[model samples]
Target: MKPGRYIIPKGTYRLTDKLYLTKNTKIIMDKGARLLRDHNAGFFINGRTGDSFTGYDGNGNITIEGGTLDGNLTARYKHYNAIGLARGQNIVIRDVEIIDVRGAHAMDINGCKDVLIEGCKFKGYDINYTVDGDGASYMREAIQIANHTEAGFNSFGSFDAQVCENVTVRDCYFGASANNPAYPAGVGNHGAVADLYMKNIRIYDNIFDGMTYAGVRPYKFENTLIRNNTFINCDYGIRYSNPNGNGTYDAGKAQSGRNTVIQGNNFIRSKIRDIYIVGWVKDGITARVKNIQILDNIFEGVSNAETMYLSFCEDVLIRGNISNITSRFVMGYYSINVSVKDNLVNGITNEVVYVSDATADGSTSYVGLGYTKDYYISGNRVENCGRSAFNMSGLDGVEVHSNVIVNASTETVGTRSAIVATASTRNGHNNKVRGGLWIKSRTFLNEFTVDDYLRKEVKLIVAKYTK
Candidate 1:
């Protein structure tokens, strides 16, 4: 047992093999115990249960509790990693502090199941941008669960294949600098996986505060639940990045997970988009998330970013949430079969929930605003919005009804419209906005408006079809 305040002195330690911790093994470090790495070592512990990458014998019943693995960032570092788990089962890492990790992940739960990381603290890794001269910032996520190997961070091409299942990260403190002088802080939790599928990952009740990157960046997975978390002033909250790390969007190329539930989370002063959505970069693919239910969330005083953002998505439901001080809650490009209902949006300085077919890169040969279709925005309450209550640029079968939209902006000239179906693209057809109380209204050809002044208490505004 390495006693308290032990120093892993300055030397070449790659000659040491990893600590193979398996069945019913418990390694408990006492208080104030520490492992200070003088060089950037490969991994602190390795749990490779299988001989090959294609299978796993399932290493089980491992518990590592309470110690500080401190990657002395000031040292001439070594390889990039902390703890790499290969195909493990029932691993519980509790009350351990992984700090100054400087290179790669704190816990690389690769091909694992039933892993729990709770009551720990993580900070000051590659976020400060001191690498091994390769310019590769490997320590992107504080705790990343991926299908990659014990090696550094690698994305999927055509040949990558693995899966992680039943992982839970709860009651942890994750903080990176909001403004690191050398490097921008990395994402709190990241998934840059492709081809492979993950299942039953639940991240709840954690505090992600003051990160420059995203709070939870889910690239692709399945059956994931992120609930009851608190995000304070992160760059982006619950966002996504490049779909498959490639340009094109094919199911075989890359795909987001189906069956995700993001609900009951709180966001305070997030810098960028609070509820972010990322699709394929250049090519038009499906949404990064499908069959998603985002419900009962609260966004307070979100500054300078869109409160909610959606891009290429289908079969999604955003309901029963409240957001205020929003910039623009816009959904652009190739969003299909979405429903935004029964939500309260207040003090929206930009579009409450606008729809466009504009991709991120704007090089959508097959993926453009013309392809965004079949969204139902109904039963929502909007108040004090600068732009239109509904800006309908998303094409085909768009229905906006039964909503209260109050356009109260300081500059009221180009503001008070129930819907703005512009003549920009051919996306101005077959859309309808009806039965909403708009304090004012506007008129476009395909962007029609229905203001039912006959209703004494409410003004119903509906716009359908343009010439």
Candidate 2:
């Protein structure tokens, strides 16, 4: 099988048992009509881009093993997508590199199920390399899995679309570098940045670098998992927003934004907050965000000026994270039922935790705005922390115990106490101290622990003298 190009005509069902291409080839779709009508089963394009292929309404399973899809592959003739699987099932695109796509998405899986994309690389079209105002900014994403909205009301045009369900991406890279500064004007606000949205999707062991906006955004999804991915120099690493436009907080409501987990990912030198929760923009209203768990991540040399901000959320947990040389580890407003525990916070000049008022309306007066409850702060070490180690001004029901706090070297006085409650004061027992002076209660006017220690030492000396 020598390498060559393979072209499928429009509105045709091209099925092959084993069609192989040895050299570079271009599979061109003839103009003035649709291309790749029903390539349902067993069509393979191998080798380089000596040619190109266009697919439209390509039903059934079509696999592009390895090649470069030169131009755009559309579904219904509107510069929409590079590859479209309309009403198709069990599509697999693996071990392929797609580049130079202009004004369209790299891969679009609409109304499809059991789709898998593994070991594939997608790069958007380069606007800078092209003549000014001549080329479109490569604004679309590497891969998009979504429902077809145009398929009017139960007519069943595009429904139940699974972009990458049971999908695994390993050792792959995706990038878009057009650099358009102007605000994008479109119907769904397209051409903003390179973004990927999925459901029941798993993105692991992949590297996303140099993106203008978010690297991966899984919106309005359920049972979606993102783990062990490295994001380098991205504007935002990963974002989860509300699918419903209504911004309401109801504990009695059903689990919304439920069971979403982001764990064990490394974010290096992010320009903005590594993880962002962008929900409820319309008059500060959004659907309830609950049951989110962030655990066991490493953030090194991240600027505190912008890092790890969450808003309008509830029932969230953040644990076992190491934040070094950063301004603030976590900042939240109007949140509820959140717990932060067992994280090492070091080398910061600002308050470790900052909670703000909900609004002038005082809607947060019930537990008080910024009030965190059922919080367990234990078994963590904090060194050289500035201002205060743990600052809970307006929060309540927060229990702090068994933490090591070391003050900065420039301070003439050590820290006032291990834990300081700014708003209203409550103290817990069994907090140990070492290598610093302690302040006694005004009524007692004594160091109880130090006095007990001296009494024991003096008794031992007198016993030695009598002997």
Against the true structure, candidate 2 has what lDDT?
A: 0.49
User: Which candidate has the top score in TM-score?
Assistant: 1
lDDT of 2 by residue, 116-158 (tens): 6777666554334354432323333456555432321122243
For residues 341-422, write the lDDT of model 1, one tens digit per residue: 9999887777777776654466545434356777777888776677677776536666666676654342474445555554
Error of 1 at 301 (Å): 3.9
In model 2, the runs with Cα more than 4 Å from the true position are: 1-58, 71-80, 125-140, 151-156, 159-167, 176-198, 244-256, 278-286, 359-372, 408-418, 424-467
Clashes of each: 14, 13
Per-prediction TM-score: 0.80, 0.64
Q: Candidate 2's error at 16, in angstroms?
A: 21
CA shift of 232, model 1, Å: 0.9
Candidate 2 TM-score, true structure as reference: 0.64
lDDT (C-alpha, whole model) for all candidates: 0.63, 0.49
**Which stretches of model 1 miss by more than 4 angstroms?**
1-20, 47-54, 75-79, 127-139, 150-160, 176-194, 245-252, 281-288, 359-370, 413-415, 423-455, 459-467
